[model samples]
Target: MPNAIEFLFDVGSPTAYLAWHRLQGIVARTGAALIPVPILLGGVFKATGGSPPGTVAAKGRWMNEDMQRWAARDGVVLAMNPYFPINTLTMMRVLAGLEGDSRFGGVVNTLFAGMWQQGLNMADTQVLTGVLTAGGHDAHGLLALAQSPDVKARLIANTEAAVALGVFGAPTCFVAGQMHFGQDRLDWVEAAAAG
Candidate 1:
């Protein structure tokens, strides 16, 4: 994937959501493919003794303002979900299950928008159903797939692999084996791709 960016993400991360959208523009500009790597952020934190920046109250407020600045600068919509730090076990399982499906990208976009753009609580079973159904997916089927042992295993493996790669948080990108964290480092990612 020298010509691609392995995008490690969690559906619950607003920064990763912003990074995802900017990476789309990077794909267009650099012609570098985005290899999506869905993982559980909670697992990463547990394994690495790391935590999201929002864990501290003042840091959380500052980070909110910072996130808003990034979103506005990137010209993407981002409203902080009132329910921050949601349990995304089921949601990430669904993403991992969609790995090879043709609808994966659309589904990812829908889920990201549902969480960040519209500021919906994606952890809610009913809200998720409405989002998926409105996004043209058979909600019941996807939910069923998420419960499969294989899908659950895949997410765990991905999370472990991420930890192995020194990935301490969401939106970690690898370009030619160089790791860059955060959405603000997208220029370096683009430069790595162009190389």
Candidate 2:
């Protein structure tokens, strides 16, 4: 097996949501392992001097349109959440907690779907716990683990690592040590994987 593709993402980013939806096909076709690294987007922004797309009104508007089209084409739901800038720390830590659990992958997939497709606010404790429980995890246990100091530190460390790696955006794919930002660059990611 080849080295896994390191997928750095934050749940609050629509771009990351789009990439998450598209990644399943890429992993299947390329036979590449997917290493999901959930980070705080704000931390990444601070560390990398990157600005969120929403800062640019014109660009952000067009991006939302493009994203809607793409999501529809891919058969993924794209309901815009009212919480444009939701705090993702809670959700990220929960994801980190699922790291070694047998339910890790399932929880990740379902939670992403819950946010991007179902418009669920993952930051809310009730919503998070419900999603985890529905996905067959011990919600209370997972939440307790997620809230631990270790998980919080690791999430921060992950954000710092992404910045150190020169990643300035969400949905960045690190394949063969080269960073490919955005779903539009999946072709390049595929080429890199092919070799």
Candidate 3:
């Protein structure tokens, strides 16, 4: 068996959501622990000179189509959020704040579904609160924690560490010290874990 798989991801990326959806089964089969590392995609972009897919019109359209095809292949529901490129600073901070909490996984699931399945405007604080409440999280407390300096610093550190590790985008995975970027490379991730 391999070491724990590190999943460095941002919620704003639908491909990351797709990776999250498939990780559980992969881990179950491979007996590898799945570690979720919340990183700000924007920070990674800035550090790595990368930009979001929406920056290019044709690429954006093709990417959406590709996401749809992958969703169909994986039997996962993915509705493109109308508010594309929603600023994820607050969300990532909240995730960092909840880093070691038992409810972290639940929060991750709720937020991912809210963004990629329910098409919620995750950039809006009110909308985020409602989604979190509906998901049974303590929205007020979580939001409060998200604003703390510690959480912000943790997120920044995570993003910087990811960049230092050669990550340039969301859904970057590390299995057995081998890096795999993008949801399309999940097969490689499984193989690495199985070895």
Total clashes in model 2, counting residue pairs 3 or more apart in sequence or in different chains: 0
TM-score of 2: 0.91
Instruction: TM-score each candidate.
Output: 0.97, 0.91, 0.97
lDDT of 1 by residue, 105-165 (tens): 8989989989998888899999998999999988999999999999999999999999999
Error of 2 at 156 (Å): 1.4
lDDT of 1 at 11: 88
Rank the candidate models, highest TM-score first: 3, 1, 2
Model 3 lDDT tens row, 37-134: 99999999999899998799999999999999999999999999999889999999999988878889999999999999999899999999999999
Off by over 4 Å in 1: none
Best candidate, lDDT-wise? 3
Residue 168 displacement in candidate 2 (angstroms):
1.2
lDDT of each: 0.92, 0.81, 0.93
The numbered model that scores best in TM-score is: 3
Error of 3 at 164 (Å): 0.9
